[model samples]
Target: MSKSNRNLFFSLYWLFFLVGISTVLVGQVLPILARRFSISDSESGYFFIAHFAGSLSGIFLYNYQAQKSNFIRTILLGICASATGILLLNADSQVICTIGFFLNGICAGANIPAVNMLVAKLSSLRVSSSLQVLNFFWGVGAISSQPFFHALSSDGSVLLPTVLLAGAYLIAFVFIYSHRLEEKTEESSRVNRASFWTVWRNPIAWITALFNFAHVGLESGIGGWLTTYSERFAKEGLISATPVFFVFFVLGRAIAPAIIDFFDDNSFIFLSLLVLLVGLVVIVFSSSYVGLICGAGICGIGTSAIFPANMARFAKIFYPDASKHATPIFVMGSFGGAITTYSIGYLSDYFNSLKVGIFVLFANTLILIALQMLVLLGLQFPKKDKT
Candidate 1:
């Protein structure tokens, strides 16, 4: 890459990093927020759903608008939306927080695709690797948010994190806008009008979506509930338990990309599912904080690489023009996380056992493994090639 290209790539990479960190801030704070607001576990899960709903909306909206505008403009809009959402969150009212989360999700939904698309456009043939690099930054963000939130430990400390998150988005907006790249108008418009539906109609797209759905569902579902699960065993109260979840969650995300580079996507995913099953079992049955922390860490490591690898596979199978179509599938997979998060919340509420709700996650992981097997069988189980 040229100097300018490399700069743009890193800029976009860090943009994704900031967004990933900001998104997990809620996960870090959820337990405390639950107590502060006196909400049920299920109700706390709604915060995630609200964010997911906004993200889902942003995917379609950005897709529609991308056809009419430049990438820079689309990203700017996304940043503005995210910044506004963070400001709303600073109000510290539950209703406002919910609304803010939704808006932030929308901003994130649009921003992610736009940034990935931008990266894809800039990268050489190794688009998968490029995307993985972007995800590494995402892991950094996810991991970094833990200490960031933990540092704000005081009365009304929540406002500090929200303010910092807002500042990150604001900085991202300025960086993206200031470093505008020029593109051929005709080429940009041509890509925007490509048949996203045709790509969606592919059988592989469905398989990818299904796997992604399961992958994201399990990852986010467990992540959303991890703090609460920790609280069940902790003596330091909910606030302290929150960081334990963050530690494992971010560690897994941060480590996944490098590992995926070494393993085939199919095998990586299959192995991840198996690890997740074991972790869930350990989490549910264990009595001590040590067991819980170990389980959460294992779960994080197992689930971390699934998304990037699945996405890379989707990109390879559906390529040349897979991005426009595949991007929506990716976003929809994220929406699946929202669905599972909500489902687990409801199940936890109904059964009065977050442990039972966790079993639902284990089941989803198994379903994903089964689906991947079927897909591989259909492909005649291609021999693994060393990258």
Candidate 2:
């Protein structure tokens, strides 16, 4: 990579780093936010729903506009939107905070795909490996998030962090907006007119999208609820256990490039899911704080490679149609986050045990494992067209 290319990559990394923090911010602070607003666990699910719903909408927006606009332009817009969301998120009102989360989701929805697509386009030769490296920075952000929150607010108020995050986005916006992005190639510039149905008609496309739905649901459910789960189950310092999970999560991603190279995409995902299942089993069955922490770390490592591997697989399998398929796949991811995160809270409220809620993750993981098995079997069962 040339100096310019390196600069762009770092910028993208920084953006994802910010994205990492935003991704888990609600989950990390869910308890505090609940207390502040005097809301129950089920009510709190609204936050996740609003945020992810906005994210789904944003993905749709990006899908429509990506061909019409440049990646840098979409990215800049997302950065600005994220900053605005953070500022709103810092507000005292719960309604405003919900709106802020929605905007934040929009930012994430727009930028996540935009950044990933940009990297894939730029590093066409090594989509999987490059995405692995790119997502490693996301893990860095996630692992640092709890510590970052603690460092800024001794009382657990999100005000300081949100303000600082908003400021950071402002600075990044100014810099990235002014930088001269590389010119788009003819391939990048071509319009993809395939309708959503066209993409959905492909069995590979729906399966891949559903796989992401399950994968994200599992990942986000764990990240979002682990803190509360610790507080309820193991009498350990909630903060301590939550970050341990993310720490291993980061380490897993950092090593994914090397680890994944040994196996093909389906093989890697299958193996990763098995590890994830083990971790989930440990978490659900374990009684002690040590066991909880250990299970979290194991789960993190297990989950590290699944998303990137699947993304790389999608790119390779879809090739030129990858962009066409990107929207629904990503939308399902956000949708999964919305439904699963909310469902966790709802189930906890219904069953009156966080552990029961967590069973949802366990179930989703099994579904993912089964889905990957089907993919491995080389199923090409596309949806039938109308007669």
Candidate 3:
């Protein structure tokens, strides 16, 4: 990569790192949030709903915004929006925090896909590998947020963490906005300009989005609920376990750049689903703390490859039209996370056990695996040499 591309890479990577934190932030803090807000499980579901709704809207809005603004300005706008959300998130008022979350949603909806588009367009590496690198940073951010905050404030000082995260975005915004981006290729620009309805109307695009939906549901559902599950069913140090799960997640994605060399992307996804199923089984049945942690860690590794690999495949298969597919897939991912986050809360409350909610990850895994098969079958499950 040239200096400019490298700059874009680091900037985009860090943006996602914060995004990962925001994505998992709710679940990590749910225990504290419940106490601080005097919130019930049903009401808690709204938090996920609000954030994902913002994210979904942001994805489409970004599709629109990308036309008028350059990437740097789009990113700066997203960071500013996100920063506002974080600051409000720290406010003492419930009403303020509620608006904060909606703003956070808009921030995520706008930022995640927008930064990602820059990374995809700017990568010096293979698109598959570059995306893996991006998401690996995301896992790093996701895993680190819980423990970092827990270390900073065990009593649920939401302000400190939110402020810190918001600061990161602001700093990143400065770095990216100042860098001069290379002119976009005409082909890339044309593809990016594809009508939203055109992509929405395609079966492949819907199928692609569903894969992301199920994948995000599993990733967010597992990441969000694991600590709570461990707290209720296993032990008290669930906060510490957050990083342990993501260590394996990062490990999986770190190695994903090379996995493409050994197997087709869809084949890797198929195997990953099996791995995830095993991890889910371990999590569901494991009666001991050690067993639970180990299972959760395995689950992380299983999920690590899904988002990036699927995304790379989408871009590759669709080729020039890849730009059109980006927004909805991102929206579906946010939707998946929202629904899964809500489902876990609802199921856990209904059963009066976190374990029941944990089981939802298993169901999502199955759905994602089925989607992977559809992709494979649609493409006739390409041969080894073909990969």
Candidate 4:
């Protein structure tokens, strides 16, 4: 790779790392915020809604604007927005904090797709392996957040860490923005890619969207609520159990490249989904602390490779048209995450048990497994895409 591309890769990885922290931060502190605002579980669900709704809006906005511009500008602007959102979290009002999460979602919606597309372009030949490695950095940031939040929030206030994190985002923004990296003429614009309507017509598109909806929602629901769930039944503190989940999550992604080398993308994802199912089942039924921790770790491992692997498949399956299709897929994912996360909260409130709420995800995982099968079958009978 050229020096410029290498630098671009570094910047993109850092951005992914920051995004990982930001995305997980809300979930990590949701319980504290609920107590602070005196909100019920269902009411607290709005935080997820606000963030996800903002994410959907950001995806649409980025897609519309990206057609006329390059990615670097959108990325830098998204990072700035992320920093602003983090700072907003330090506010005393629940309404302001909700808005803060909403803004953070928008930042994620914009940045995730943009960065993924850029990295795909840069590593055309090694898309799967490269993406797996790139996402491993994301896992690193995610795993770090558990202890980071735990240590920083010892006084039962997350304000200090949020402030420090926001500052870090600002520093990253200046550093990435000042770094000169140019897009290739052909890659600079989205004009050559398939239109949204064109990509929308394909069966594979719907399959991809559905899988994203369920899978993203399941992952978010689990990650967002696991801490609270564990707190009720397990002997550990609020943050202790959550780290085990992310540790295996990080480990799974870290080793995915080698795993994919031994298995095809579809096969690897299939096995991973099965593992995820086992993990979810363990969490839903287990009463012991050890079982809960083991289940969380299994879940982390199960979810680790699905997203990046699916993305790599999407790009390969659609090839020349993949870039344009990403926005819709990601938008669906954001929607899924928002609805699913909120649904878990709402269900928990209704049933008066977090375990019952988690059953929602368990059911959704079954649906996701079916969707993966369809994707696998679709791959065997590849059709000429009319778009």
Best by lDDT: 2
C-alpha-based local distance difference test score of model 1: 0.71
In the predicted model 2, the residue pairs found to clash are none
TM-score of each: 0.88, 0.93, 0.90, 0.93
The order by descending TM-score is 4, 2, 3, 1
Q: Which stretches of candidate 3 lie over 4 Å from their true place?
A: 67-69, 180-202, 381-387
Clashes of 2: 0
The digit string of per-residue lDDT tens for model 3 on 1-387 reads 578767777777888888878767767777777788888776777877877777777777776765543556566777777789878866667777766777777767787677666666665247777778888898888878778677666565677777788888888887787674554423335535555555567677778789888888787777777766667774555445567789899899888887667888778889988888988898889878777788878888888888777777666655555654577788788988988989988987898876787777878888887877787777453333332
Candidate 1's residue-wise lDDT over 87-189, tens digit each? 7765658999898888888777787777776676665366556666787677677767766766774564577777877887787777677666554333445
lDDT by residue (1-387, candidate 4, tens digit) is 988678778877887888888877778888788878888889988999988887887787677645644567777778877788888877789999999998888888888787787777667788889889998888888888767877887555787888888887887687678653565333433444546556778787777778888888988897788877877785454446678998999999988887687777778888999999999888888878888888999999999999998888787777656765578788889989998889899988998987788888977799888988886775563321221
lDDT, residue 176, model 3: 80
- For each candidate, what is the lDDT? 0.71, 0.81, 0.75, 0.80
Give me the runs in candidate 2 sitting further than 4 Å from their true place: 185-191, 194-200, 235-239, 380-387
lDDT of 4: 0.80
Two-way lDDT contest, 1 vs 3, winner: 3
**Candidate 3's TM-score:** 0.90
**Candidate 2, residues 1-387: lDDT per residue as tens digits?**
888788888888888888888888778778778878889889999999988987887787787666654677777878877888877866689999999888888888888888888788778777888999999888888888777876786464778888898888877776677654564522333235544456668788888889999998888898888988888775545456678989999898989887676677787888889899999999999978789889999999999878888888777766656754588889889989998999999999999987899999987998898898898787743221111
Kindly report the root-mean-square deviation of model 2 from the true structure over all alpha carbons: 4.5
Top candidate when judged by TM-score against the true structure: 4
